[model samples]
Target chain A: MSDGVEVSVVLPAYNEADTIEETVRVTLETLDSFLPAGAYEVIVAEDGCADRTPEIAARLAREDDRVRHVHSDERLGRGGALEYAFERARGETLVYFDTDLATDMRHLEELVESIRTDGYDVATGSRWLPENRADRPAKRGIPSFGYNTLVRTVLRSDLRDHQCGFKAFDRTALESLLPAVGDEHWFWDTEVLVKAQRRGYRVKEFPVDWTPKGDSKVDIVRDVFGMGSQILRTFWELSVSPRITRRVSLGAGTALVVVALLLMTQYLDPQAVLTRMAGADPGIVLASALVYAVSWPLRGARYRDILSSMGYREHWGFLTGAVFISQTGNLVFPARAGDAVRAYVVKARRSIPYPTGFASLAVERVFDLLTITLLAGVVMVALAATGSADQLLVALTDGAVGATRPPAGGPLSPSPPASASPPSLQ
Target chain B: MTAIVASARTDRNFVRRTVGALSDDSYADYVAGVVERFVGDVQTVAADASAFGRVGGASLLIWSLDVVTAIVVFAAFGVDVTLAVVAVGFFAVSVGNLAKVLPLTPGGVGLYEGAFTLIMAALTPVGVATALSIAIVDHAVKNVVTIAGGVASMAWLNVSLTKAVEESQSAGDVEVEADD
Candidate 1:
């Protein structure tokens, strides 16, 4: 059992009374061939546990000296626990894995070997990425889709799997990135990779066999959401730091501000415009307001639908906020700058890409238009039969679609006969 | 799932019926086509169309409210019945088409209402026309204000419209673009 320390196995466990022992047994059994029998110590940083997870872990520690266990009464969560384990690991290349064995032992060995002998700075399990970790349930896969998206956009981290827990890091890369990752919970995966990536570290992913940890404590909503924000925070921090070489531009924001200022001028005389507005009919005002307030949720829903269809899952609150913000931007910024803003926010918060985000938006608009067109044709014709066609026609013709129609009689309407308008070569 | 089911109830009756009236079967067929085409183009087919990280839920609401808003305002302003039909119908179709041109109005705030009023006013009675106009202008003002707020928030959030629109577009390659 004589061997030099090549791979250090760091297991960050919180409360794994049900499956941890199995995870260690499998790893030890499988890893004995690859590395020396006593070369590796399974450094288990047992985070504050309320159950027998710590006690059981301690018992195992006594059975094999290689099974080292450290108890930190203060719960540093997933990220902090791993940080501790990595710091105390005995191997030259530190590898931290999920205690539930989501990543199978064979893949774990592969991961360690990929970095130990090879020159890779970090190796992670990618479920949907090029080197996919493993097959995942729709629930797990769906959230990863969203998490990866947010990571790509907000942090500009190119890695496809943002939340994969089974990963190995070179001691140099780990030491460099570990300090920057503050999230004590889930997002720590991205924090480290993004930081590592930004620092010119070579990170690679491999598809590995993994099982969805059945008794896993991952609160998808709370933990995922919290990680999303932290991902953005890390991205921002990385992007702004002179120490990091990778960053992206916040595009056209200044020009957007300039145009927004111009649009604000229109509402300045809301009272004054009343006469002009009411002259045309106050009905339009009320209708317009209804459209504005109500569209928020609808637009949000549209986004939700597209993402769901795309297999990306997120909370409705985040989506609605995205729609509200984006639509609101389009309204004020005359040049359609709101779309950019909306995409940026969502990308920042959700870790999805801008291109993918806006694609859904285009679809929502088309559907919306088709719906509007249908109403106009049928309802207007009905009004025409009732002799109210003129008013409805006026509304439709005046560019109710959010553009200025040919002014009252300037060219298109009532000023001259249709034949005389000369088709205007529009 | 419930929210999705609830929102997916896009009130096809209105869309279907509206499309159904063009020229008997012609109208119905046309409506059906419009529905198909519209549904086809929407982000429903795309995988990543959302505001931030959530999905889009505003289509039905936006469409329904457009109709309801028009009907209510026209009624409230004491618009003549005859004029209401044309203005309401006219704005309805035009609003959707307008979205096509811009490819990115966010939520069609000021432009939608303003254009709706201008287009509808020319074809209706003074009373009805005036009411519809006011409805549109008010919506525009609010929309403009909302856009302003969104811009402010974008600044706070440090995002851009291009990023939002492009990301959404990336969710599905509908090939739809901003014409205006």
Candidate 2:
């Protein structure tokens, strides 16, 4: 109701009929102590109250011009109610505190002045700071400590007490941050503060005297589980989503491959494989590995040619690396998932369109299949020229027991025992 | 060549219809351009007759190296280097690589080994154990080489695979927005 309200204090009320009148009176008296008449306004954000809290707020708004009553038919959550009232408030500096007024009223001036005159973007009272005078019971204190610690560690926040209700925000700063803040309920405060810091806003956290109030509506399941998921969501949005650059993708891909390799040991004994590999001629195996290594650059060259024909000329080294990453992704992921990975790499790194990337990859694959068929066809012709056609027929049909074509159900048949005699060399 | 062109046309139309159904007219048009560009690239390759010859040469050379790797693994097992066995190894390697293209498993690990072992065992006088050993060793060597090259390339390119996957996953919407 004030004409030139510089500060608006919103009290989010949900069925607080017993204390609404006294809380508003005390809030008015506190405002009168420091602010000039008509300089500040008190908004009772009555959020779908089932009791007479809305009536009391309406009466107070009517009785005093400094008090304003805003009612919501539906339960706009705590943060929602505050946001609703703040948008309607005619103030450059917006402040909000719990209806309980657990924090000493003496700190109210400091909280408002920090944003109004001190030039800070946000200011919040802390109950977790070493210098605080909060008389917290063990039941509340332990969970609060754990929650705040989690917020600090997971969200990378600097604030010690994020959920402190006694907080003030610069109107412009709050508005700039609200669009990105996804939470509507209890996680709102932590998200806002974390995002505020990330966006380079100067936030001030001051210790305040506080007393433990009566039973709060903190459900064990919702607060712990629901908010726990919210933390991960915010962490992803704040820390992971924006920075999902090519480097992070490669790192994640590598991590996935490593995890896949680790998981393979559960199904296949790695020690047995390593021992078998060791039993082989190490020199010949090294040569084989080197020969395979040489093919990678050629693979890169083929990829470059395919892309170049598409009018997207790129460095051969870069193409080779892209091929390598995609192939590696394929090695660890199923159904040629690495193909898309390669497409993604080229599109992201070279600004080539996705369609082109995919097409170039397809072109490369066509050549691969063609080359494979050509090799098999040439070898088949050679076998026929040498009077070995009968051997090919027998192999195609059934030559020996346990040596037929792989079954349709699975690729790997049971391995024969190690002591089995080596078959004829030629 | 005719099959490639026909497939290209079918793909372009499919892309256009699919995109048109999902988005607005302007966005669909932009997506159609994307498909056109893709089809154009494939057709360009198909048009250049020598491009096929050159790619064939490269692929043959690369796949020959792959066959050579298998031959070397056979040599490590002390198999005689007979022309008949080498020819059989070439066929088995080619067929094994083709089997891997099925995408049944990562890098077709089990699939490649199965096909190679089956062909080598049936064609030659090799025991199942020796054939499976050769198949496993050959596939493992190639896979190890591939993984090493991939890691080296990642470090060299200074790009993130995770980020690329994420962006590529959301590429449809992002491309439409950019074009619109």
Candidate 3:
């Protein structure tokens, strides 16, 4: 807002000696149509011009107080030159467009006002919008369509036209965006627009009347290869690399393991398993799955109790999810690597130490093993007291020596020892 | 060194043949141009003894850090950190790293753990579970450290890691083209 200037329109001029003066004059006239005198300034950002562009810009700046010449010693590329000029601009709203005046000047007020008064952080004119009337050659339109589609698909951009030269930005928004923008050339504004959207900035895109300039600036090889690579680079930064975080990797790893287990199920005849379930009393099958499902919450509650003893209290639901993820991890990984995953999850999510988590897991495993052993011992003693141990041994020996048979309950439960025993033993 | 040169020469022809089979005449010519550039680069590097020495020394140092990290992780898990144990750890790390170079999985996730566990179980008195635990912990530590460093450098430079890498690669391409 220096010198009470409300808007700064920068024309990034490289070798535009012919159009520099006229562009500045038309820009001033357009600004004057809507803005008060002394409220706007025109900057001829002369980027290392070897022609009469600098001289013309300097003379214009000298003649009119509203026009100023910001010169660079070397080529800063298109984005670089604009960024250089923008840093030195004194207004709250900054605007730029191609000096070719290809876009109609009638839309300048809307473009400026979109940011200045409409509260949009960024505003850009799109030729591809249905309302816009533009006469673009097939050569330019094809490449533009492909490039914009690539940006939208890979970078997840919402804009229809990214490389449009007519764009305006609120000074504060541009300042916040410039630091994260890596491109300093044709891709600069596109990167800014994409990043501004990501940062939740309010951007407005409106259709504008346009005409193709005399010759196109799109070099197929350079623009395609360079900008295509930039799109992938941004994709990697925004999408791929962020997923490399430990928490994300943990989730992804668990998901991959689950997918792998599902794929492994392809080895089984799913129809046969389903047929067995259908034949086996549907109520029993459903009850069995429900029984197995009930064990998970019990496990979670047990883990919560163990953690509580260790002075790390946590909710059973969260603990249940953690346990589920770790068990999923175990299905694929070897040597019970899932134990470590559980340790990591508890430590990361609940602030519990790894050693404490591992200790609790060890205690749980010991209790499980002991319970199974005690139950087996009790069964053996009961069989001996009933004088059926001899019958049981004979039945086991006969079964081992004969053809195997599926359990009576089918795949719903393990082989039924009671059914396998001799009638006397049973 | 001779083995590597022979391998590179074989790979150059292999690449040329593959591209030639897949592409037409103009693309074949482009492939030949790229192969010549590759040959020139290989010759330049092969001619520089000091460069080779520096790279080799740096690689050895990095691998040593990997082994030391494994040893620390094992010690944390209550493994006896004896001289013999350290030697076994070094062998396991080397084998694990070599196995992962095959690119069988992303970031060599499964391969590294498998090789490290196999080596540790075969050479030391550690059981399979203990060996696997040590391997998993070692790999996690190294990966976490690497990810943290990458994130820090990205923040420091105010650029994405991929963007920086792509820029450098493009710059290298430009330099090679200039030389051509």
Top candidate on lDDT is 2
Off by over 4 Å in 2: A216-218, A255-426, B1-180
Question: Candidate 3: which stretches are off by over 4 Å?
Answer: A217-221, A246-426, B1-180
TM-score of 3: 0.47
The list of candidate 1 runs beyond 4 A from truth reads A1-4, A129-133, A215-224, A239-426, B1-180
iRMSD for each candidate structure, in the order shown: 16.0, 12.6, 23.0
Residues B121-163, model 3: lDDT tens digits: 5445554445655676667555544344334433433433333
- Residue-wise lDDT of candidate 2 within A1-426, one digit each (tens)? 546889999999998999989999999899899888899999999988889998999999999888999999977677777889999999999999999989999999999899989999999999988987787778888888899999999999999999999999999999999998887777788889999999999999999999868875455434654578689989888788898854565456456546755754664455654655556677777988988888888888877777777788888788888999998888876656677788788876788888777667767776677678888888888878876777657756764534333322222222222234341332
Best by DockQ: 2
Reference-based lDDT, residue A283, model 2? 75
TM-score of chain A of each: 0.57, 0.63, 0.59
| lDDT, each prediction | 0.59, 0.77, 0.65
Model 1: what TM-score?
A: 0.44
Candidate 2 structure quality by residue, lDDT tens digits, B24-131: 323244445645655555555766656656766788899999998898787777666577778889999999998887755568876677788777877676545567
Span of ten consecutive residues with least summed lDDT in model 1 chain A? A410-419
RMSD of 2: 15.6
Q: Write the per-residue lDDT of candidate 3 for residues A289-326, one digit (tens) a residue.
A: 33334445555666675566556789877776666655
Q: By DockQ thresholds, what CAPRI class is model 2?
A: incorrect
